[model samples]
Target: MEIEGVRTDRLGLLLDQFDQAREMARVRLAGLGDDEYLWEPVPGCWSIRRRDEAVTPRAFGPGEWVLDKGAPDIPASEYAEVVRQAADGMTVAKIADDWSVGVERVEQVLAHTGPPEPDTSPVATIAWRLGHVHSNFEGQWEWTFGERKDPGLLVDFTPSAALALERFWASIDRWRDSVASVTEEQLDTVGFSRYPHSNDAECPYVTVLAGANLEFIHHMAETALLRDLWRTRFTTSG
Candidate 1:
């Protein structure tokens, strides 16, 4: 079916791009099993655990599931401070060379390493990552475009992989319906979504849509890479 009310080719293209990214996410989710989904390759890794078994110190309110502590991506502002302190204005390239890793690897770690903890690093299990993206995308849609007034309250880090995939696909379906119904004027309007997590208060509605798509793509890629690493580590060991 063709998308309606798309006044410009740009909007049409953006919607198409979102679809492509969503498909990639679906492919990544395929064949994920309960064991692999909740596997923690290392100690102290954040993952979905039973209510009785949950160990993360951070509280995410009353829920059947809890997000393992340590959010992905050290805040950029914090990371900048760390870089200044460690290397004293050295370029990213210098940091990469010093670490004996590729520049991209250095950038990722510098930007995303978990906060300092004693003998424990932040590692997210597949289930946690999936739950995060699903909740984020869905919450944005709910607060920005749907009936929900509070996005933060809508969070759910599902304990099971199957449930996370279900939520994700449901969000995708809602997204397609929402996108199909969007009018040109709505895209042009500012503050279309009152989502407090983003700069939506100052940006055009189209920007929010674009930003959400970027989030989906990157998180999906991260989950895919984790799956590959899991396979490699287990396959080699087995």
Candidate 2:
């Protein structure tokens, strides 16, 4: 599992999982049928169903939105149940799609670019990914690197509603250029974050990164799956 021409290491592990997830995502996308909007595997899940919203997923039930967006002033209890349940049923492509670029910004940029394809596609959708990445950012910053922010409900940046993935598609590189600069030390440093979890006296940063890597890939798979499914639906119905 090599990336950017670098031999395998812990980052390789995370990237390997990401690569495997990409393959799984391709398979799942290949399976999607046509004309199946308003459907998610865990249909029992709840979400904010409406246009003009973020692309967050359903957790617990309806009205389960995370109030804070990585800020430490709020209680984790607000989004704890949501995050806890997130660990239960995970998929990489959806996670990737969920890891979208901010819809508004993406859309604004893509308006000139046209074709919303990128929004559902990886690389383009940076909103959810940024949030997901921040999950790492939160840990790396406050705990591992020891920054000074809570990186509040990193998930809330997600919308319970579907997003303009095409526009999202256009925004991928925005983060790529930024994240590409992250160093091993930045990821390994302790005490960058002020969040309770990051600042925990007992826990360490390496472990936090290890776990975050597994999850980051899972959502990537989930996002890819969603887009592939959406593609199937688009082709069959159109």
For 146-176, candidate 1 gives per-residue lDDT tens digits of 8865654565666567777786688778877
Against the unseen true structure, what C-alpha lDDT does each candidate score?
A: 0.69, 0.38
Residues 1-238 of candidate 2 have per-residue lDDT tens digits of: 4668875766455545545554563454343322232344333222223323424332111233332122112122223322332454533332223333234432333233333223212122223343344444443444333444444433233342233232222232232233335566744655332345432232243445455556556666655655665557546543
Residue 71, candidate 2: C-alpha displacement in angstroms: 19
Error of 2 at 31 (Å): 11
Candidate 1 CA-lDDT value: 0.69
Clashing pairs in 1: none
Q: How far off is model 2, as Cα RMSD?
A: 15.8
Error of 2 at 187 (Å): 3.6
> TM-scores across all candidates?
0.70, 0.37
